[model samples]
Target: MYMRYFSRLMSAMAGPRPVVFSGPSGAGKSTLLKKLMKEYDSVFGFSVSHTTRKPRPGEQDGKDYHYVTREEMQTGIANGEFIESAVFSGNMYGTSKAAVQDVQAKNLICILDIDMQGVKNIKTTDLNPIYISIQPPSMDVLEKRLRDRKTESEESLQRRLNAAKVDMEISKEPGMFDATVINDDLEEAYQQLKQALLEEINVVKKVNMSS
Candidate 1:
């Protein structure tokens, strides 16, 4: 009976609040997030976003995102189903309340990796989350990182750089984020992220052990 109770508790909705990660395109958010999730797989879950854009090569529905038609997304937004939604480059993208709740139901910390606009939209909602901004060491470093990828055209690269500048500025606004992690040294940045989330991490660990 106690075991059953523990199992139920582990799956309860009272788990840790969701976490929001906002940063520029080449800010090492993915690398740091990969490390954290790999280290604590059972304790973290990524909140899959919804998008009206067609899936890219190798993208899977419900995994990379919930691919929907423009009309469907529009209807969902109209009905107040999405917690935060935005239109980017002619495609609509959003984070539905259900997506976050799905992760919470599993008693894992939900991670919302979004851009600056999405961050601003979420700020207006009642869903309280710990916002963390991952920033590159400098504009030069960010440019270098993007160049290393060699995936963007000259035009696309320039666009990303411009957007990164705006994102960096927003991240600097006082009280915008709970913690701003400048990802200069990958190891040090990971350590800082862990420290910022230490309290919540401990809670999840305790629940896991008890279960």
Candidate 2:
């Protein structure tokens, strides 16, 4: 009976509030994510993404991303080492199984910063997560932010604007995500995200008390 109870307990604790944060290029997704990681510190573990693209200036390996060769990535994919992966702009990016495991082993909430394609793929898997999409207030505002960054060429900036349009449209789909957050106000958006993450713990506590 104790063994059975232990099994149930583990199952309950197995997927503790891992979040998949998806948004467009200039949607302040990374900004909000950094706040969570920095403020919460020990509570969240970032599953560093793997990419076949060469690192841009100031990016670090295993810190910003795990840089790998296309050949190596394909081999790892064949070996079942990636949970979800996608090709964008002729480069491969993925969340590796090892990266997730590393965070989970520490009992931290693993945060995955993936795209819409990765989000779609993850839903089919058993690694259930709270899906949240951060959206800009408007396309014009999104365009302004991208332009202000000055990090993109005109062509790349246009591509991002188009992608944002699609993302905003899809985010409105009821089943695509658990929550759609507008990032017009940074602090307000952060508060919303923080509360959502906290709710998972609250739910489990309520269940335990009743059980």
Candidate 3:
């Protein structure tokens, strides 16, 4: 039928999609992402974020983040050069459209490490990325992990814990994420995260081949 042909045409055009990783501080998001990058090598790439904040010690221009001046950032926003931009502590932070395109151009998965707000911001765009939330098993474990890893003061720790509480709650909402992987066990969580991230990729590949 005509409908079948149309569906196959759409499938022929299908390709890799981006991946969004959202979670709270001290959640094992970074660890899992590191493993994926290390093992898969060139299968994925990071969409470097742009920031108005001054480059920190030993930080590179495009590797760590695409550091830009406030004026430049504001101009980019006005020109619609960014997929999403937000202000934090007087610094303008954003992800450029070109940054994401760079990864896609390389035929690699564009992985974004974002907060809940960033996740929501990305949802407004046409990029329908696979959303995966890395959450701690419980608030108690989250608190302990932050305390052990970070040397921040007790007050700062409390602030982070409170923010994690909010993130934990929001992540439970239906349709907020395609998959929610609890980071209770690092190896187990990584396996789950890897599977969720790759399923979308497999679908795109299969569709392209069959079409």
Candidate 4:
């Protein structure tokens, strides 16, 4: 069972570092993240990002995203309120500094799920987060996974594959990420992810046990 008592252990012991998760689409990043958070919900919190796009059905403001107008987002960006921002499909998306601070203030490690560009942008700031990249075993495997989803058109699938190629290559660059997890098997990959964070986990455990 999880040590539920240590919900605020991270904040009590130390200023927890944020953890950034980035990978190509269909690399199982979201799945792995879901598993981690489900098991250690108290230890991690996801920072809500801001977007200029319209919300889809069932999405809540300040929960799914801090929905904003284009003018508002642009103002925030100009004011340097965002830690990282990017324009896609004529809409802007970003993680604001306040969002990360909100999670940290709750005594939890803020988890950021972003793209390669966001990673690079964060690197310029002083957030000093642990960067982790999730990747598929190979391009062939990634292609299969995307296809198996059965949710993409041929053009969209090809576009994702193309982007994945660039993402995979960037992941290999020197010092781009602290850890690179190749998701060959779900269980094995999850174990590897936990292993990489074992030090932090143990720290939390030690703090909880001592208290």
Instruction: List TM-scores for all candidates, in order.
Output: 0.89, 0.87, 0.82, 0.85
Error of 2 at 157 (Å): 1.3
- Which pairs of residues have clashing backbones in candidate 4? none
Stretches off by above 4 angstroms in model 3 are 1-15, 54-58, 151-155, 201-211
* Highest TM-score against the true fold, candidate: 1
> Which is the winner by TM-score between candidate 1 and candidate 3?
1
Given candidate 3, what's the lDDT at residue 47?
88
**Per-residue lDDT value at 199 in model 1:** 90
The candidate with the higher lDDT, 3 or 4, is 4
Runs of candidate 2 exceeding 4 Å displacement:
1-15, 201-211
Q: Give the worst 10-residue stretch by lDDT in candidate 1.
A: 1-10
Query: For each candidate, what is the lDDT?
Result: 0.89, 0.83, 0.81, 0.84
Ranked candidates, highest lDDT first? 1, 4, 2, 3
Candidate 4, 1-211: lDDT as tens digits: 1123222332343457889999999999989988998998877889898999899778899988999999999998887677789875467989987788788776677899888889998786666788999999999999999999897789889988988999999999999999999999999999999988778766655654565
Candidate 2 lDDT over residue span 49-161, tens digit each: 99999999999999999999999999988777777899876789999877877877766778899988899988866677889899889999999999999988998888888
lDDT score of residue 6 within candidate 3: 34
Q: Which residues of candidate 1, in runs, are more than 4 Å off?
A: 1-14
Clashing pairs in 2: none
| Among all candidates shown, the one with the greatest lDDT | 1
Query: Which candidate would rank higher by lDDT, 1 or 3?
Result: 1
